[model samples]
Target chain A: MVNHSKKSINQYAGYIYLLPGLAWIFFVFAIPIIQLIGMSIRQGPVGQEILGFDNFIFTFRDPLFIKAITNNIKLLVIVPILIILSLIFSTFLYERIKGWQIYQTIIFIPVILAVAAMGIVFSQILQLKGLLNETLRVLRLNFLIQDWLGNQGLALGSVVGVIVWKELGFGTILFLARLMSVDKELYEAARIDGASGFQLMIHITIPQLIHIIEFYAVLLIVTAFSFVFDYILILTNGGPNNQTIVGEFFVYKYGFIYNRFNIASSVAIVYLLVGIVLMILRYQIVKRIDS
Target chain B: MKKIALSRIMKQIIMITMVVIALVPIYYVFVTMFKSPDEYLFNKWGLPLELSLENFKRLMEGETIFRWLINSLIISGFSVLISILVASMMGFAIARFDFPGKSALFVAVTSLLVLSPAVLVIPLFKSMVKLGLINTYYSAIIIYTGIMLPISTYLLTNFFKSIHNDIIDAALIDGCSLFQIYYRIMIPLSMPAIVTAALTNWLYVWNEILIGLIFLQSDKMRTLMPGLSLFKGKYTTNIPLTMAGVAVAIIPTFVIYLMGQRYFVKGLTEGAVK
Candidate 1:
């Protein structure tokens, strides 16, 4: 009876510790999110009454909305490219390539810098007569020079290029770290079986790092969907003519710029749903890894 | 042996090219910041005829960069501290206790770990407006704390669980209250994790432009990122000046990253890897 009472008391005390943080999350995150759902389903300035799914219907028909989703989907191509580049670079570093130490440090620099700031820098570099074009000219590759961020047809591609450049370092370092932690015995065992370098990586390194790769892929997907806002907002402002407008930018434009909060809320709801699905997938992966 | 040596050389060449690609823009920014505007137009990829601090001077004198920097410092600093404190407390509760609904709460928080708060911007904006926190430091700080809590708490909880329970039991037997055990034992023991969480939150809040841009709408209230971004628009013609602003904005993160590279790497990979 005495032990039982002490255990019960401990259970209640836990709530005290959880209270302040939960309260902040409740008020600041939860309440606002609830409002988001409410606003998504309503109409007009007052944001009262059920308007059914009209806002969502309009959003579906909106061409800009389609453009935004398409642009985000288009950005998905970066994930594979990122993974491949990271694997290659990390493998090189793992083999202790020349100057690997300096290379590792320099690469991660971009990952830590502000996306908005780097976006601005890239904006200048991608301009019609900017440093990139100048460098191309100097190298006698003037044929490759174009308005990297200006031409609507090429603007999104330019944005992708910039994202790749900035993000490559993160994956490389992450993979390298994981690779370092991997058992050297595994590789040695493979080598004794007459496995070539490529074969060793294909069978052993890839399998050993599969879980982190999956986690990173999901992260990159979430990033493509939402985190590219800074890049888009800075690099193109979704422009030359809305060619690079993405889901997050769509929400921001409709909500803040256009004052179409209902439509914005609807778009946000759609994105939120997609994000929740990904998060659930990620949660399961993390749970499996943890267990 | 010859083939292996050749492949090694090929790998070295590719990596060197990648390193150059990575460093060029940063190099260009630093180089441009030291050049005169006219010098930048004429010498886009070369050293200036003579180095000039004029652009930096103009950025400092002509804009509110310092004010924005200070605002960013206050917002990120306070938000990181408060979130860490709140997260450590919550982590302790979750790690040390066995209450009903505990698993549910942990799942919810973990699910949110991968969910960026960008989608919540619209409703969050309305809430901020309703609360009349639209232009204050509290606006960004509060939202940032909430945004960071799930991950912070998650990291701390995992760390707290690693700490042996004997320590806690001893504290309990010695009559140290629950809160006393937390503050006296848990806090001191979890400094590395707390620092990791703090650095992660600081990086997010500092680099965050969307929430800060929307929440802190006024000119004097803007954080460094939004300020620098908007400044980029108005001053597009002056490449050197824009580069100067970029250089200044990148400095704090660069300094912190250099100082705590290990912590930064640890914090980021801790989430994805075991």
Candidate 2:
């Protein structure tokens, strides 16, 4: 009876300990999620109405929104590219290439800088008179000196290239971390069985990395959904006629820039819905893959 | 055997090429920070004849980067402190005691990981504005603590579990009250984990831009990342000055990264265990 009383007291103390954190989460996260619904339903010029899905209707109907979604899908193409690239490079590091540690350290330097800073410098380098074109000119190959970010078709591609460059090493490091845990005996056993390195990689290494790949892919998807905002904002500002627009940036453009607060809120809701669905799908697929 | 030898050489080349691709822009950022405008315009490729700090001088003289840096330090510092306190307490609660709703609370917190500041941008902004928190250091600091809390708690909870329960049980028998055990026993015992969480928080709150962009729109309130970005627009033609801002923005982070990179990779990749 005394022990039961003491256990209850500890439980009570536990609730007391959770109070501050729960309160903060409630105020900051819970309230905002609720407020998002309020903001989305608001309509009229300054979102004066209290009860319509007009903004939601308009958000879906907007052509820019459509373009942004497609552009986001296009950007996700980089995820598979990143994963494949990361897997290949991490395999080399796993085999202990000469100076692999130095290469690993050097490769992650780009990952530390703000995308904004990286974008600004990349812009300077890709300018018509910038190093890229200038180097081309000096090589007596002026034909390659076309407007990189200035050209409409090329602007999105250029921004994507910079994103891939800055991001590639992070995925590589993640895969390397995964590689460290794999038992070495498996590799030796495969080798003793006359398995070629290529076949060993195919049958053993890649399968062992399924969970990390799933985890990495979810991160890439979230990045696709949200992080592209900053990259697009800095590098192109959704420019060369909005060809590079993505959902998060579109929300920023409308919410803060255009002051379409209701519309922005609507877009954010749609974005999170997509994210939750993607997460659910990823979870289901990865469980099956893992099992 | 021959194929294996050839592939080894090819792998080395690819790795070397990756290193070069990763580093050239960073190298260029430093290189361009020294060039004279005439050299910037005419000679875009080669190293400067004489290295110059003039661009940094002019930038320091002209921009509000100092103010931005101070602002970031203040906000990130405050956020880190508050997040650690809240997370540690909550982690202790969840880790040590059998509480009602403990599983539900854990699930809720875990789910919150998927909801980044990006998803919350619009409502969060409008709510901050409604509360008259726009343009205040307190605004960003408070929001940062809340946004970062889930991850901080997740890490701390996992860490606190690794602490043997007997330590707490022994402390209790020795007449250490729960609060005393937390402050005196738990925190000191979990120093490495706390430091990892703190370092991870610093990397995030120091580097977050979108919240700063919205809440701290005025120049005096701007943080380093956005300031550097806008500095490029303001000095588009002046390569040295612009690059100086980029260098300033990245230098401290670079130093911190060098010092605490292991914690960062471990803390960031920490979720893989679950």
Candidate 3:
């Protein structure tokens, strides 16, 4: 009975120890999210307002808002495909082949570089007078060369390509790590049962990676909105007439550059809502998968 | 023998192709950084026409590159240090002690794993302004600590839980205080996770652009990412100089990872496995 009481007291002390971290998160994170939602509903000017839903109404009615949503949707589609490709690449490299470490190191280099640097390098490569165009011209394939980052239709795609190049390394590393943890006995058993290479991957490896895939999918989507700053700012500046405008960039432009705080706040609220919903969905999916 | 030779050849080919594709842009950056404006334009994809240090000279002479580099190091270093210290403590308490609201706290921190900092930027900015922390290094460090703490804590908690409780109990019985056990026993035992968390958070803080751009307006206070943008503006057409700036920013992280590759790989895979 005395030992049980001591155990309970220690457990209670554990909760006390957690207070500082809890308080820090609540102040720095949770409160701000609440503030964003509150500010979105309240409105006056850049620093003053108490109007309700007007900001949301104004933001939704704006044409750029629609464009940002659509562009984000396009990214949502493109990034997952790239992630799948990365998974395929990771699996190929995970075969305990010779020089696998060297491959992993090389692939991960791009992930270490700053995004601003990537933007500048990719911009130069995709320039009208850039190396990519030069290569195409040399190959007598000038038709394949267009102003990759200049054309409105292709600008977002160009940014997406750079993003894929930059991110594929990290994704490959992550998936490869997860893949290594999977028991090799499963693969050997499948082989003993006469399963082919393709069949083993489809039947054993892919299903096992489903939880990780879902986790990474949600991570990529959230990052797609938050982390595209370097791409937008450096590559196109959300331009050739807002063709590459994403919601996060929209918030930045309005809030920082144009001083449209009310509208930016509303947009942020919308973004937060979308992020929360997607995350909850991912959580549910992962929970179901785990069980 | 023929099949073995073929397999060896196949592996070489695939590895080489992947390496070349990966290294092309990096090579482009390094090669251009050593070339003059004329060479950069003429031999855009080739070796430098004539080796020159003019771009690097100009970059150093004209800009606050060194200052930004120092600022980035300070911010990343301090932010990562504080985050690890605080996160490890929180993690230890949660893992070792069965406490009320432990599950709730765990869920709260874990949920933050999915919360994007982008969505929080505006409100955070407002909060910073209200706190009179705008345009200050303190703001950046504080915000970074907050952002990183949750995930690091979560990772460390997972790591700490994996450690045998019997060892901790032994230490306690042997007259080690709670803090002593945490510092001497728990932390040393969990070094791999701690190192990995520190490295990951360091990279995030170093490569971070969004918060730095918003919170830091002065040229001297700007980190590498924002500073690199200024390099772009000045050398708008000069690929080589821009690449040099990029090279400078990338080398430290690369070297660090290489030096600690064994621990880095082990930590990442171990932490991620669960």
Candidate 4:
């Protein structure tokens, strides 16, 4: 009798244990999300009366919205290139290339620096008269220098460059982790068959990373859409002619800066939708490649 | 042997060049912080002529940096505590017991990981305003906890489930209470996972800016990154001073990374449960 009662009490205690986290999830995520949908459709201010899809209609109407979408699309192109680069780097590291631990530490350090903090430092370093240009002048390659963050033509590219620099090592580390676990005999057997390092990587290493690549692709695409906000906010503030505004930044500017909550909420929803679509599409492509 | 030696040299050279490229910005930032403004202007490339703390002193004399730092420390500590406490319990229940909403909750938590709160910034802001928590520490703390709980709970539940069920069964037969089983056996066994989860959460809370920028509107309550952003804006001309702030900002995380270097480099992927 005592033992059964004790077990029953503990089972009921599980609900009590769950209450705080459930309540938090409810208030912070679930409720605000529903409210977000409701607020996005309202014809007027947030919390105001009436409902329609006019806000979303106006969302599709804006040229900046298109620009934002293109800007985000521009970010996606960097993912595959950077991932490949990181993969190559990881291969070299895995081969036990000299002092690769140093390289790992050096490369991975930037990943910890918040985007805003790094943006401030890099803005100064890449300025027209900053370190890069000054070095270019010293080397008599001044023609290679251009206004990085200040030029409308170059602003988005500059932001993307900084992002790529920060993000590359993460993929390297991820690939390196998986590569470390591969049986050494596979590499040795390939070597005995006269396979070079590059061949071994292609036949042995890259195939092993398919799952991680899929996961990484989904992560990168999602981050590429939503995570560029702080970088844009700090480096260019979506300027050099507002040429770099992505969805998150657009949501910020319209909602908080301009007091257009209805519009911002709709943009938020659209960004959410586009992000999901991108993730799904990436997953499918990865899945096909994976099989 | 000679051919191998030559290849090794070439490899070292390539690796060294890449390391220099990677480390230069960090080295430059650290170097600039110690340089006087005059050194920054005149001999920007070389080592500082005089090691000076003038910029740091100037930075410290201003109260904003200290306020922001304290605010950050407080919020990070608060969120990590709440997250571990609530998250561990929930994770334990979901992992160990037969609950009514167990599968539903697991799916919900896992799906929540995909949605970074960056998507719903506007609605979240409105929600905070309605609660009149626009500028409170508790608001930011609770928000951080809520956002982080999914990752925390996911990590802990996985950790808990990985424990040998026979061990728990043995404990239960020996008359160990439900709570005692968690603290005595499971927690002690899973210290590594808890440390990993806690460290990752701490870093996330510390580095987070978007919500802090929105919710903590006042200077006194604002966290470090947003404060750091505003600090850069106001003192853009004072390059060394801003560099000092940047150096200070990166130090804690850098030190933590060093202390937990193995976990950071090797364990991050394991931590990426999804």
lDDT of 3 by residue, A1-291 (tens): 124645866766666667767777887789999888877777654456657776777778889999998888888765577677777678768886777877888887777677787788888889998878988999999899999989999999888888887777777777887888899999889988988666877898779887777767766787676568778888898998999998888888898889787778788888888877876776676566447
Task: Write model 2 residue lDDT over A217-248, tens digit each, in one string.
Answer: 88787677767777888888898799888888
Alpha carbon lDDT of each predicted model? 0.86, 0.81, 0.79, 0.81
Q: Model 4: runs farther than 4 Å from truth? A: A1-11, A44-50, A278-291, B1-10
Better of 2 and 4 by TM-score: 2
Which of candidates 2 and 4 reaches a greater DockQ?
A: 2
DockQ (Cα-based) for each candidate = 0.68, 0.57, 0.54, 0.52
Error of 1 at B49 (Å): 3.2
lDDT of 1 by residue, A76-132 (tens): 989999999999999989989989999999888888889888889898888887778
Among residues 3 or more apart in sequence or in different chains, the pairs in candidate 4 whose N, CA or C atoms overlap within 3 Å are none
- Candidate with best DockQ: 1
Query: TM for chain B in all models?
Result: 0.97, 0.95, 0.92, 0.93
TM-score of 2: 0.94
Candidate 1 lands at a TM-score of 0.97
Per-residue lDDT tens digits for candidate 1, residues B1-274, read 8988999899999988998998888888888889887777678778777777898788779668888999999999999999999999999999988888998897787567666566788878887788898999988998899889988988898999899988888888788888898999999999999988899889999999988889988889999999988988899888888888898889899899999998998888765455
Candidate 4 TM-score versus the reference: 0.93
All candidates' TM-scores? 0.97, 0.94, 0.92, 0.93
Better of 2 and 3 by TM-score: 2
DockQ of 3: 0.54
- Please state what fraction of the native interface contacts candidate 4 reproduces: 0.48
Q: How far off is each candidate at the interface, as Cα RMSD in Å? A: 2.1, 2.9, 2.7, 3.6
Candidate 4 lDDT over residue span A112-213, tens digit each: 777777788889888998888898999999789999999999888888788888887788888888888889999889988988767887898888877787
Docking category of candidate 4: medium
Instruction: Give the Å error, residue B65, model 3.
Output: 0.6
Candidate number 4, chain A TM-score:
0.89
